[model samples]
Target: MLEEKKFFIHEDWVVVILAALIIALAVGGLILPVPEFNWSNASELFQTVLEPRNLGIIALQFTFVFIIAAIGALLNKRPLKGYLISFPIVYLITIAALILAGNSQVKAINLEAVIFSLGLGLIISNFFKLPEWLKSALSTEMFVKIGLVLLGTGIIFADILKAGSLGLIQALIVVITVWYFAYWLCKKLKIDDELTMMISSAVSICGVSAAIATSGAIKGDSKKLSYVISMVLITAIPMMIFMPLIAKYLGLSQEVTGAWLGGSIDTTGAVVASGSLVGEEALKISTIVKFSQNVLLGLAAFAISVFWTYTKHPNSKDPDSKPTIGVIWDRFPKFVLGFIAASLLFSFILDPATVSSVKSSLKNLQGLWFALAFTSIGLETNFADLFSKQSKKPFYAFLLAQTFNVVVTLAVALLLFN
Candidate 1:
């Protein structure tokens, strides 16, 4: 006698209900009347996205992201790391496409961001080890650049220029100088190059994500990546809290303060949080400036890849022995191309209505997806690899860039935006 059994491990109803909940909340947050419990005005959600009160709501949402990221600690020991790695990658890719395409089909859930983040998170939780080839720029760091590219729809470059071109110049100076300082300090300390780079970039750039990306770029050991992320996330909480105090103490104008915070902070969520606390004008100005620098990441990554190819390869000893164009192509991640393409296409092709729609949708989804993505990052990386002695060099590199980033960025912020 044989008993027939259904082969389902999870309930379809539960998946449907979660999906519905996410979607309904996202859309309702934007379309329906928000309960008076919070000050969110659904009617004005799209029109006044940059308003100070709305910015507060956005900040409130990011709290969830931080919590999930902290929970990543739960998955540290087991098979979760592998799942952590891949889930963020895929989830990020989807959000990129959705935002770049300018579709605000959903509201609060940010279907695209959630899909990419949760999917990636699930994968990373289940599987952390990757093939040697996948570990290179292809899987992690390059995709971060890709995420930045997709984020361009939210950035209106013309608005940035109108605000102040030198603002961008200041930001670049800050990011580069801090990075250089971090690098030099690490080298003098004889810290591992890969880990140094991870920490430095994460600190200098957009926080945990950048740290993870650089770790992959330099073939940093896993433990190095974990510790660097830990340092960045932990320090970020305080930086976000204290930056407004520094801004006001320095007597910076709202716009100037915006530029300063945007330029200085490592995480986008943190920047937005700090900026909103200052004033409405600061939030708007800071977000735009921060995005401008974000756009530069692709070029930086490319430059780094090229530099590494020429300087460190076994064939570097021979003047004529260089990576063939093919080898260069092979080593470089192709995902960045998709990111660049999305930026250029949107920059030239999209009209106002389309861009508006795209931004609205992404705005709604951005924080939540980012939160989930970082959680996945936390899940995959570990305390062991992050603190390892082998991480000295990468740590040095990351440290170098981040130090330069803070000083130079502040100078630019004060001079131009002031």
Candidate 2:
């Protein structure tokens, strides 16, 4: 029998480190004079990097990522030497991709950093066989979980409150409606339960993160997860670029357009990109709506887990035995709790000025974590597996569901935001 791997630390320790890092950064921002920076334009971002202060920021980022990668190496029981050597290369590639995506021309087309990083990694992985040691360090799930926890720091409960009942209602309607539609469609197309859940969650909530969360809850196939992720990413690009243009052509108000984009776009990054194309008000409203939807991820995962577990084991020897609170708690994604805690802490505990300062300083770090995760995803995913014959049904199911989402969300945005 293969020996089970041992780790110096449990996986949960990574979550603690992520939480501590966010809190430390937030507190540090309050005490330190952090430099103001922008990546709004590619040329400007590249120029900014040459500045001493920005260079220091970059070094700090590298140090933080190195520590995280080291921890990942330990958890996977891998040789630290190879991981240390390869991590910098991966990090640099992801950073370069981010810079490229931030360029004025790329930004105009709304090609996000996540897409660039994934594409770059996919090209390298497909064209050349990567070293086994390097593959060992590609901890996509860990990076994504850390990113999600850090992402919580940016979500302020006050913002959700400010968005009012309409935002919550719209999110509820879109998530529930889209999720069931996708699930039912997949079943009709004879897709497996695992793939159906993954696609449904990706369509209804946030994209990659939601798919990851649901897959964990259902213990779905990694290749299926990658397929759903690819579907979301590919569909998101066109939606991100064209949605704003369509809104403009229809003469929709910025708020309505923002809500529509937020509800329809699978990824938060894509929603923000699409909303930015519309206007400032659209960007703000889009973020609020997206957050409102994201807040449902934990709940959705838990619900699916219960449904999966009970349905699969319906004839349990003890028919009287039903899933308990323990089951629900176990099924819930802990990172979501961290995200919520971070959001609540930033919104309610911190003073406004400190919160603002912290948000500004730490925002890019979250993006970097997500970029790394996407790069890892691309590196691990084989294009052939993602587009296999078994995936055809899921592809059609996702396409149909997302089209329905777009139409329904647009109508709801008009009714609520307009």
* Cα misplacement distance, residue 373 of candidate 1 (Å): 3.8
- TM-score between candidate 2 and the true structure: 0.87
Q: Report the poorest 10 consecutive residues by lDDT, candidate 2.
A: 29-38
Q: How displaced is residue 313 in candidate 1, in Å?
A: 1.4
lDDT of 1 at 369: 47
Clashes of each: 62, 0
lDDT of each: 0.54, 0.79
Ten-residue segment with the worst summed lDDT in candidate 1?
A: 30-39
Best by TM-score: 2
Q: In model 1, which regions exceed 4 Å deviation?
A: 1-149, 212-223, 314-320, 362-372, 387-404
- TM-score for each predicted model, relative to the true structure: 0.62, 0.87
